[model samples]
Target: MAEKAPKEMSFLDHLEELRWLLVRSTIAILVLASLSFFISDFIFEKILFGPKDPNFITYRFFCSISQSFGLEDVEICDAKMPFIIQNTSMGGQVSFLIWTCITAGFIIGFPYILWEVWKFISPALYAKEKKYAGAFVIVSSLLFFLGVLFGYFIITPLSVYFFGSFNASPEIVNEFNLESYTSMIKTSTIACGLLFELPIIIYFLTKMGLVSASFLRKYRKYALVIVLIVAAIITPPDVISQIIVTIPIMALYEISILISAVVGKKELMESTSK
Candidate 1:
């Protein structure tokens, strides 16, 4: 006997399901955030402020690279970040702690959130596709975390180094607000995480017949320009930093094109067989 397909849901039912999904995801995030409060000091000191240190891992790695190539005069090999982070308002510290925990929670609970999203959409999938739920969640979560690490290690350090060292005049000292500093860190990590989803996004778009490998190839130049623009937006104004950011993103775009091609090929074969 064959298994029956899932019954179609009405609009109201779909909305109700989506509402519960949000509720569950929110609860998970809050729980994780609450747990994070216990380790707030560690997060602030080690994770958030790590990039600000001259001896940070990223800085050391780049310094080694510069030394290995005999580029002894590179600023990263010797310069220090000169900016200080200050909270301007009485409630600022309290607010920053709360938001930072929430951000941490979201990052930690990303897999659960993806699972909830998978559940919300699974009813519409065929049984074969539904069986791949574990793979979907795992792959998406892996990609997201990779993106986060890339942003934290590569983008954050470069931005901090560049902006902190830049001076219009020797008289002007760099004192970044606490909010501004944390915001930069958060934006860099989250943006890169989402940006790293390009291949997955292409897979879905190809499945829905909305995008094609040829389309991506045809617009390769435009995509490069867009990638450069996005890199510039995320990194500092320096050419080297911008180039560093652009490299991985362009690689992701190229991978997306390949993913789209593979998906299209599979769909074509399936269609012909049917």
Candidate 2:
């Protein structure tokens, strides 16, 4: 038997559908977050504090890279990082656990959220368009995870190293608040994960006629500037670090342009055929 097509929905019905989707997504997040609570110890101790140690994998890799240049006294190979983490408030840890689980929930539940979002949007898309759902979820999830890894290994470590090693004077000691430290990690991971969705965003924008390949190409230089600025903001104050971070972002932009162009051409062809 053929599947029954979804009925055309009124505006209120659409809103109701969206509300349910959101409710479901939230439930999925909370469920995953609850699961995360059990593993909070591992998340807190190993992954969160790992970068603070000089012997962390990322630091060791960077030190290895630096040594290849025969730079013996490179900052990355330091004996110890120069900061300590502390909790300033009574509810600090309780607050941290709740927020951390929520963050993990969001990350882990991202695929389900995308599935819900696709269900909402699928009614509006053509049969052919609906077929890309799997691709959309997989590609987007992969991009987000890649961005998270990049932020953790490259951006987070670099930021940690820069701030941890920085001292105004010998008299001033850098003591990082637990909340502040976690915020940095969360921001770095989540922000980069979202940023890596640029190509996907452009694809949709192009479909909606809000952007085009020509426009993206024309503003390439401006986009490059913006990319460099974002790289500088996230990375430590160094040319090499900025370039290292900028490369993947620039590639994403290029991918966005390509995606936009493909989407544009497909739309144009469809209109011409009609």
Candidate 3:
């Protein structure tokens, strides 16, 4: 005998499920954040302030490339980061530590969060689709982490370098606040992480008949402009940094188009076979 279909859930049941999902996700984040306190010093000094140092890996890598190309005059080769980060408020340090740990926990617990989200939505999916839950969570988490790394290594350093080095007047000193610096890092990583989910999002949108490969292709030029705009918003107001950020995003958009095409084709085949 064939297996019976799952029973339909009531509106209240769905809400209850959603509530549990949030509860579980929050617990996971909190647990991970608590663990982060054990290594808070490393996070603050090595990871957060890494970009602020002139000898940071990103800066050194760029400096090497400049020297190889005989672009010694390029400012990227300069060994100066004329800025200091300070906390003005008495409670600022404590608040920053707590929030930063929370952000880190969110990033680390992303896979668990995705699993909870999958469980919440799995009831609505066909059995075949539900079986791919593991792959979904893994791929989504991988993409998110990759985006975070890209943001940290590429966007954050560029933003720090540009803002840290820029002096409107010779007498002005760049003393950045702790909150502002941390905010920039958080924004860059989280923004890129979400942006990197483009292909996954496009796949679902195409599957839902909300978007199409043709639509994406037709608006490719517009997408390019939008990508550039996002890059400009995220990176320093320089051609090079914006272009560096734009390249990956545009590539993701192209990949999203391809994903949409494949999903569209699969749906078309399924409909035709019916």
lDDT of 3: 0.87
lDDT string for model 3 (1-274, tens) is 2232378899999999999999999999999999999999999999999998888988777667666767667677775888889999999999999999999999999999989988888777776787799899999999999999998998899888878888999999999999999999999999889889888899888988999999999999998998788777655444665776788888999999999999999888878876
lDDT at 64, model 3: 76
Q: Residue by residue across 55-162, what tens digits does model 2's lDDT show? A: 888777766766776766776677368899999999999999999999999999888898898899888887777888999999999998998999888889888887
Residue ranges of candidate 1 with Cα displaced over 4 Å: 1-4, 229-244
Model 1 reaches what TM-score against the true structure? Answer: 0.92
lDDT of each: 0.89, 0.87, 0.87
Q: Write model 1 residue lDDT over 196-262, tens digit each, in one string.
A: 9889899989999999999999999998998788777655544665677788888999999999999
Give the local distance difference test score of model 2. 0.87
> Which segments of candidate 3 are over 4 A away from where they belong?
1-5, 229-243
Off by over 4 Å in 2: 1-6, 233-238
